[model samples]
Target: MVAISSPGIGSGLDINGLIGALMAAERLPLGVMNARKDELNTDLSAYGRLKGAISDFKSAMGSLGAIDKFSVNAASSSNDGVFTVGASSTAAPGSYSIDFSDNGTNQLAQAHRLTSLDFADTSSSIAATGTLRIDLGGNSFDVVIDASNDSLDGIKNAINSATDNTGVTATVITVDSGSRLLLSSDKTGAANSVTLSDVSGNVAATLGMTTVSAAQDAIFLLDGHQVTSASNTVTGAIEGVTIELNALGATGTTETLTVSRDIGAVQENVQAFVNAFNDLQGMIGYLSKGDLQGDNTLISIQSEMRNIFNTAPTGLGTSLQFLSEVGIKTTRTGELELDTSVLNEKLAEDFNGVAELFAHDDQGYAFRLEALADRQLAIDGIIDTREDGINARIDRIDAQIENFEYRLTLTEARYRAQFTALDGLLSSMQSTSNFLAQQLGSLPGSAAG
Candidate 1:
């Protein structure tokens, strides 16, 4: 039989309460270990916030490191209705007076359109078995006009659905009398003109197609020098500049296209970086007040970022080599500040010189800071190493807690066993005393009581 004994049943001792009191002392170390685990977890959460801040700062570094951030250019046209201008990194700062000449024709480039005579209806047979070769730009396709599909709509669909129909579109338009088929080049410019020829059929001749508009190239005078483009979207006339002719222009009139270094763009980009840095500073400040107070890794990260901006880049071969030269400064509160006026002045005076300060391949502040962040966030890097160490410590504490709980379990069992045995002995001693008292009372004063 399994010995099912209740310790307090016979002796009336509070054995459960006594065992609970003893086990409370045994579990003292557990309370301390659990509190330490909570602290470590809080530290982990703080590091998470710091890691996110660093990542955002790294993205800012990438943005500021880009060479294009400094090379931005804004191009403007005197009359945007007549033309618009776009400038790329290769475009130098300059101005060009634009005039539409086109051999003094004052005409924009036009796409070719061929319209066929009206037919009786869409589904009626318009042609016998015949074929026509259609060509546009570098693409050509053959359309068969036969009894299976001979109506105006059929012919339109056949030309449109041709396998190799390149840059040509066919559509049917309703005329006063009937429906008419129209063929157009899908592209603009003289080089992309459409051509239709009779091939094994008289479809081209039978349609009596008339030219609605002829293909033409755009010719504009750039500072009295003739610049020609097959398309109205003119490129390569000026290095890295594209001129989009919006409308036909007269010979006597002209518009000025000015390409200038966009100092405002650089200012905006730098200001954005400054704002991000300040936000990171604020985040670090907030996180420091909590579990990360006086954290050495966070301190090192902030110090490196400050050092990158404070020191002048070497080997740039330019007088403008420091961020302060362009008006970025550190304030008393440790936040970055930008003075757009000074930055604009510097950029206007020497754009590329200003560019060297921030975007140089090797010695630039952005470059160094980006590399630093890469090191800090890389595999087994600074933050990673710290996180790994914390995890290892937490794991050790967890094992300690697990083993401590096992010991407490055994300790509680032993306490109960010892108290149960004491209660049993006390109950047996009371039983013996009661037996002796009952015998004595029965012999002497059993009746008096």
Candidate 2:
């Protein structure tokens, strides 16, 4: 509660007549108390943001446990030496050959051999009603051809729109002043084949090609085993990876390739952790730096807050200590620096140990540290306490003012009543004395006569 000095109306009142002096005495302490309360409120709010960010950072660490760091290299490629490449950490590493041939698996590659199709002549127009049929694996579809429009471009768009199952694509090429509709599978290997039927006007005649092409399966040399696939895409070939065919044919010779996890993503995770730690440190530093000469109450509370961070909570994991173990050293300027190469090497050697350091055993030191940081940073925890204290002080001052006002009112009323009675007694005494003196003087003269 606030304590104020006695006012002019009270028993212990300082009767300094100067208005400035009186105003200064009342306003200065109130301002200080209010300022201290505001500081607490600001600090508390900052704490809340920090706590949330820290919690999220910790949660992100927990999620990191599930990610697997991997390294892979090519075992082999097909005999046809010129090979396509696809090796993601999420993909299985094994030798695969994309072929346009038949096997037991669903074909990833679909081949369409164009026959007497309508886009044979350059200037010819086929109606939209005219249908172009292409077989995608066993499923076949008739595309509504747009011949009145440019047949060369329209054929590509039409085939693409007609089928969802057709992994292969279509195009029209003009050679020697003649247009031909060309359909090719988007995926590699034999399974991605398309066979075109039902055509009109010189398309095959222009190309000089015959016998519609059939779809073939993918052939892979899996761990030295010759495996054939009827599909261009394969899943679970290895865990956490999928393969999509980008090109066609088995080049005669096999090649070796290497695959690994994305290093950039791992680096980002490390940086996030570093940022969160720095934020926590900054918040603590701000609260600790208080004006010593000004009101010491705020300073005292801030000191206590600093102490909360400085002490180590028991039951926390030793692994979670950042300052000593991870090679994060403080400079003379009191800023942190990380030995990244060393840290990375340690992480590579024992990633589990790195994880253990950040994660506490259920309800361990790390968790406790997180909780402490949360409370210290939260607006309600710090600001609310200070504000409440200031308000209590102000209430006490108001009460004191009320008591002083009550006593002054009663004393003023009694003084007025006593002064009135004294005036009457004085008046009566003056009149009687005057009359007695005059009579005494007159009686002496009469006796002489």
Worst 10 residues of 2 by lDDT: 65-74
Q: Write the per-residue lDDT of candidate 1 for residues 192-243, one digit (tens) a residue.
A: 8787788887888778888899987887788988776788898889998999
Q: What is the C-alpha local distance difference test score of candidate 2?
A: 0.50
Q: What C-alpha RMSD separates each model from the true structure?
A: 5.3, 14.0
Worst 10 residues of 1 by lDDT: 100-109
RMSD of 2: 14.0
TM-score of each: 0.77, 0.46
Error of 1 at 139 (Å): 2.5
For residues 232-306, write the lDDT of model 2, one tens digit per residue: 455555454444544433434334433444444554555654565565456545534632124443444446534
Best by lDDT: 1
